[model samples]
Target: MSKRMNSGASQQFVIIGSGQAGGWAARTLREGGFEGRIVIVGEESHPPYERPPLSKAVLTAQKPAESCYLWSKEKLGELNIDAVQGNRATAIHRDRREVELADGSRVPYDRLLIATGARPRRLNCPGADLPGVHYLRTIEDSERIRGSLSKGGRLLVVGGGWIGLEVAASAVSMGVPVTLVEATDRLCGRSLPESLGRFFMDLHLRHGVDIQLNANLTRLEGNGRVERAVFGNGEAIEIATAVVGIGVVPNTELAADCGLPLENGIVVNESACTADPCIFAAGDVASQPSSWLNGRVRFESWKNAQDHGVLAASAMLGGDALTRDIPWFWSDQYDVNFQLLGVPSVGNQVYQKGDTSSGRFTQYFVQANRLTAVAAVNSPRDLRDAKRSMQNKSQFDTTGLVPVLTL
Candidate 1:
């Protein structure tokens, strides 16, 4: 209804998934002066909200669920955007240029953006569907896990990834004992380097967390809820509550059903355009070619969600946002603020500017004398300093009274 266009025709933009990507896309469209009918379909009850805090702040009771909100319902109305909450998009009728909803209504769209995001990967073992088995992806999930922690029982965290480590840290902050198990030999094998995993292991161990490596959780046992965990080695641990932080699976069934290409996620170009020119994809559900990583990747991070959503919307508005910026990710656990930038590979030469024993250091991943990636723990300033080397083919400046480790 807000007409900024000079054309005689009206264009409608519809976005699926009312999460970070969807919300930002809606805002970016209005900001770009796309005077058209914008409709956002959300499966959740709340408007688009941040999820990074759900593991740490919300789980530890440091912040309320309201703190995660990005935009309120009234804000969407102010932008003249129709945000349909508590409803899901059932199908996309591409032939009709319409999206069929669960409520049996079809919304016609001139162009569509699918930011469906992803769902937590569930375990296939027995007793996984029990009431006490929790997954942290939403505000309600965080609150439910927090409630379980407050009940005064030992919490078993499966998978030693970011989510698992954060949940363990949150439990420790609340005086709840935690036992973390990782199927691999080290923690965060997929996201972090092997050397960095040792630092995280030591950090959790210092906080009295029972961490088990090269461990596999075979099944959960309880009367009506999760009470015990059975490992692969026939060892069992008494756990009152369980939090599974394995990973996430992209929601690509919708795109797949509509006959779109899928490779790990919805395949998109650098401009976030899919196989169909009229439809685009972004955020966790989109597998786009990354200029930073030099490969097609589906990044599930807050940085990617915000940046990619903006890029998609910009491209939709006839603007050029055909780029994947350098990957940036951060996590907060207990007193640590760990940040990771760029991709870390085994071939990169690892270097550190500060002692790991001090619990604050910056690690650089160098390739051919050029810094390609950086990982910092509690050293935001040092991390920012290392970023310049990522562009220049120069050695890291480790001058003056500092400990440097080259591995």
Candidate 2:
């Protein structure tokens, strides 16, 4: 148990995990009139940087790793943030109101925020730890994978999720022969509708990517390094390297050790407040309730991190701000820019306008005739209008909207 101590008014605001959420939280606190001291402790030596570009721009060498930084020393200094890099918060001593660092140092705080992000979910096959096995969760990982691409060998992408598909697209663009494998029956089975999944399949097929669905991996057979992958059906494919982009597991060990309530992630209400009054959580680690869906959901997106940080900071400052914003995520594959608004349900009626084969279309998902969600591919204009209609809770009228949308 931690020592109990009274918190003084002069105590500083401490934030653990200096990713987008932590960076934005520190900045938002200053903007929200927090005049006391602020300290941001980060495990990574590098200052806050964006992770979305790691899979695309960074892997393609189009953007350098430094280009993704979220803040400069001057910017953080201007905001009065004491940036402590290369330090990991080992434990949260709630009773003492202090966070213990890996280096045996402790930082006292009146208010503490945990934004420890997440790590890639790794597989446990025999050759899973081989030299060629790679996962993209950080800039360093991207750099390693990009270097491997330059070596020139057949690449095997395991997982058909967004990250896997994006990496596959980038590999294809580099003129690398790629083989993508997904355990599910279709690509993006967890997110996109069946029709959209087929559309994506067609798009990738046209690009020369050999996609295999409903295929399960038995093990990776290699000598010192990966040379081939064995499937469950006794089929083996010769490959030079492999990249896995299945999903991520939130960094909740510290929170769990502190006895914080967790369901999928650290439990928090819409206001981002944990069970402890002085402690709060945000970003991927916080599972917040959603009034739009009338349930709790955890969002792991760049926008969610930025928005949740601001909202969590406001709540920590004794403000009554709660976020009920619609969740949106986008992916860039080849030449198509795919965007999804709100969460798509299985039973929602899908309506398509424009031609999908031509790489320009807007998909409207209506629940009981009320516009609920929108998906667009290379059609930004329709996406904007569809978003407005969905937010306004307008009923979709095919006859009335045809003239305006050219349906």
Candidate 3:
């Protein structure tokens, strides 16, 4: 067993939360030649694993939990990291530079990385606590959902975001009937553009997934288990399993308890450094400055988490490396792979070419005649070229660029 240290021991590096960000930070620190005492504290019993697979592959039993690992326990131990898993960090005693765990043990550190990720937001409606009500976040959650989805059951998905859409696609592929409900008029309302959102709606519709927009859930009705859902319009639908993918709430209690100023997330600079010199943050729980968005933005994507983790580790080790990577995100629904490069804003002039109906199309969002972002549907090579163009700050020739991309 890894020895637990006292509160007032010599200052070393301590990472809270063993998610992607924390795992990468620890590895990056070692790679950057930091041979000091390192401690990783996690509330989850399992080691760090890829989270994007949870909604699709793992939830549908296409992949196993071991395949999602960023680093196995043996690998982490080989790196000489003292891992304390299955225990939650109760509080942060900033005055003493110590972190209090649920088991009354404390770990002191000179530098701390709060990679404590987010949790799924729960619905306040009635019957939400039923047996069939599930939320996807951890591997265990995905396992439970996979078991519930066996033999093709009727699933009521309550959200229109990436997770909900991905799960809907997975369930439909497994021959399950999925009815997705969203409170908004369009899917991915907060992320994708309205036109793109409608395109996705059509895509899902073509895949035989029932989608309901502008529909608010009043309550989930069941007999000791989630069996049906009631909408705001008094419409009811019978369902065997209910999965909530509304969104996630950042786990910022530890940071907040230490008096860290949080706006949307733990406020961090371009280098992922927090307000205190001894503390830093990264991944979904960090609201850091973005060169692409021209402001501070919090991105909840695998790319951001992994990249920011490296940047955070570099900053913690007295290296200068600000995250300049343009935000990129991808989603797989049925046969289509949707990829987006750069930040898509409202003012961009939308340009379209090729057959979107055939699922081979790309949308170029140009702001002031300069390509700001590009959305691709099953067009990987074109998306790569578009990303390279953005990296080079090249303006798009709307007349020929679109046709060339299609070629």
Candidate 4:
């Protein structure tokens, strides 16, 4: 048990895990006119920062890591939010409404928010513990990748998802020989359609990125540092470093320990409230109920996390508004910006509106005669309109979409 801080009659609100969701919740709470003592606990040394730039812009030397912060230190001070950085929350006592930190300290709160977020999944095999193998999920990881790429080194990337593909693009642009391996037959098999995946395969191959589909890694071979990777198909590739981008696992241990409803993440109602009214969970760590998608879904996107933060804060302030914003996600790869709007899984039919070969197009995923999702590549105009339509649940004639784009 940790020592509890005496809040001294002040209405204290403690938020666990100060990443994107935590930062947004703190800001929203103050903005919502809750003049409570807002305390945000984060495990990272730095304040809450954006993660999308870690693999693309920051790794490619296109942007600085400092530019990714959601709020400045001075801004946080002005908001009167206490940011407890470099400290991990070990447990949550729901009965007492207190949070325990790793350093044997506890903070009592009138209300609590869980925004612990997710962590990158790691490869577990021989030489997996090697020092040179890296995963990009934080600013430190991006800085290390940028430093390694500066040497023009040979890089082996595991997984063919958005993170792996984006990092491979950056490495190749830096004149680094890169090989990307995926267990699936195509890149982004879970997120993208086969046509788009094939297009990405060709695009990466044309850009000098060696992409190996349906390739599985057996083990990582090295002395103390990663030197080579052995594929399950009896093929071995020599490389100076390897990056593993095999998705993320939600940090739901705390919620689970506290006996909160958890499926893929911390389960919450449509209002982002847990079984306990005083406690709320949001962001990637939250399996929130979405009326837009007609189900409870956990989204691991930057925008979704921020939106959940705002919604959860509003709910805590006795606001009953429901969040109907269609889930949106974006990724930047090789000078191409890809944006996805709405729930792609709900789409039954897909229509491509522009030339995919030119890498500027929009693919609409339609379900039950309604547009359910839209994936736009280098087409921000379509992406914005698609988001608006999804939010309004507007029905569009598939045949007339291309003409609308022209106008």
Candidate 5:
């Protein structure tokens, strides 16, 4: 077992970034019988909340912003957590064991957690900083985009990643016309294979969304707000509101400045412990070892945020780490529930089952007769079984895996 914090002493557990990971870590510390002074610092004024709904329910105005909050003020108070809101962590003074904030405050910690989540990669083009070009990372951002969609006009969505697709779907659901621009030829190029990308393409295309592939956006041309977008292909389209969902840049400045190992993100062990024994990192800001990947990887999924937070807290309290599961993530686009379990690569042989015409099927990726990854469209049960197959690393069984479609 790892050495626990000295609870007998006036232990001060300071958590930086009150996002999913930080909030859960604070609660875990309290729940794990650590009677310590816990403080959770967040740049946002709101308490810890889930961001998944921002592109889905919240964007479509199906749910209120408060519904995404993981903890209410009353709940935070009940946990005895000193919630410091609306303060950016400027620097980490490792020698002094303190973190300096933008407000000229230094908070000390016996154990520190760096959960500083990532920020949206702003669109870089002419008139990019115009008023109408928005990025969705917070509830406030989502609400603003929702307002824009409600006003009724063509919404220009840039990037073909999950964020852009979700935003486009939400707008379509809101009965707003959407024209999606992708620099690449397909959607979610990094995560999805060509076949899966086609699935998404068909999904959006069927929904009456104008998808422009290999269409590089040159610039935004407008008077006040963004009124039009120019493409490298010498085509321009007038738009009412614009949303950029290119990607996110992980907030690794604090970790890098403080001298914690940084790669794509703050390097940490499976237990979420950093190189420095006094500190740990988790969530989107953490790049930790993954058995599934056979290497270290940084995940930007909601599952990673919550699980890593709990793991970090357990490690802090000298408790056994939680069971690591296969990295799984799901997306709700239009009316289809798309999910993927395990990391899919290009070389894997895909054996697809079920009918895509019905809009419910599972695609299995196998290499060397072993299940490597699985993608499902509205087939949660098969996806659940796929998780078990992945956990066992079982050889492919064609008994029930009869391929109706092979990719």
Candidate 6:
């Protein structure tokens, strides 16, 4: 076993939660020429893996979970970093500069990075404790869901967001009867525009996925296992299984217990540092302040998490000051590819550059006659250009944007 401490008072870097952010931080430390005792503590038994495929390819059994791992065990060994997996960081004693583990061990550190990610929000309705009810978050969760889906049984999907829709699409492709319920008036209401939302609504409906909008699920009725769901609209539907994809709640209990100021997530400055200079945070768990968006936004996207990891690592290494790029996200549902850049808040004037009726187009959100954000469906070329335009905050001729689409 490698000694935890080296000669002299070399810096001890401890990272909690071995997700994207934590993994990146460790890698960055080595790459940045930091010769310190680096240790990563993760609660999961497996190493940090990519999560975007959880609801898509992995759930469909098209790809194995091991393929999603970003770093190999050999790679970590080569980097000379210690990864303590399957151990939870129970508490942090900032005054003593030590992190307490659930196994009754304490690791002293000179600096700490918190990368605890988010968890799927559980359904609070009655009978939510049934056996057949599932939530997608980890590889284990996805494995169980894949088994349930193999039964070729009725699937009741709760929520209309990306995860729910992606799972619904996968289940439908497998010939499983799926009924998706959303509490909102449209699908992806918080992220997508009405036109794009309607386009997806039509696409799903045409593919035999029964979608119920404005549906408030009252309870899940079953005999020790999920059997049916009763809605507030006084309608009941028999279901073999129920999958909840409502949203996520940041795993900030440790930070909150330590009296860290948390608004939606762990509050961090542009450098991804907390109020204390010795501690930092990133990924979905970090509510980083964005200078580009002119507000503090906790974005739930793969790109954001990866970007945050890089930025936080750079900041920790005392590199150039961190800068927030335009937030971006992508989703693959059925045959359509949706990409969004920047924050598309409500009341932004949307300028359509292509055919929305045909469901292949790009919509640019213009505020003050400047392209602030964009959403593209089946239009990757436009998405790339729009991303550049959004970064520059430049104006483009609407007619010209339509012609230059082959990038």
Best by lDDT: 5
Which RMSD values do the candidates have, in order? 2.8, 4.0, 4.5, 4.4, 1.6, 4.2
* Model 6 steric clash pairs: none
TM-score of 1: 0.94
TM-score of each prediction: 0.94, 0.94, 0.94, 0.93, 0.97, 0.94
Q: If the candidates were sorted by their lDDT against the true structure, best first, what order would they fall in?
A: 5, 1, 3, 2, 6, 4
lDDT of each: 0.86, 0.85, 0.86, 0.84, 0.88, 0.84
* TM-score, structure 4 vs. true: 0.93
What candidate 1 gets wrong by more than 4 Å, as runs, is 1-9, 391-407
Kindly list the per-residue Cα lDDT of model 4 for residues 1-407, writing each as its tens digit: 02222322368999997778888988988877777699999999988777887887788777888788888999989898998999999999988889999999999988899999999998888888787789988899999877866765689999999899989988887889999999889999878777778878888999999888888788988887788889877888888888899999999999899999898999898778898888999999999777656777899999988988988887777778554477788887776788888766633577777887788999888776677888889999988877776767778678755422210
lDDT of 2 by residue, 1-407 (tens): 12322222376899998888988888888877778888999988888777888889988999889888887878878887898999889999999999999999999998899999889899777789999899998888999998888888999999988889999999898788999999889988778887788889898999999999998898998888899999989999998889998888999898899999998888987778899988889999888887657788788888899889888888777777664567888999999999988877756767778877789988877778777778889988887887787778877775533221211
The TM-score leader among the candidates is 5
Which one wins by lDDT: 1 or 2? Answer: 1
| 312 Cα displacement, candidate 4 (Å) | 0.8
Per-candidate clashes come to: 0, 0, 0, 0, 0, 0
lDDT of 5 by residue, 317-378 (tens): 87666788888889998789999888986577788888777899889988788888899999
Cα lDDT, model 4, residue 349: 71
lDDT of the structure predicted as candidate 2: 0.85
Tens digits of lDDT, candidate 3, 1-407: 02222232344899998888998988888767777888999988887777988888887788898778898778988888888989999998988999999999999988899999899999899889999899999999999988888835699999999999999998998899989999989999889888789889998898888899989899998887788899888899989998899999999888998999899999998778898988999999998888788788889998889899999888887777654688889999889899988878867778886777788999998877678888899898888888888888876788854432220
Local lDDT at 153 for model 2 = 90
Query: What does the lDDT read for residue 238 in candidate 4?
Result: 86
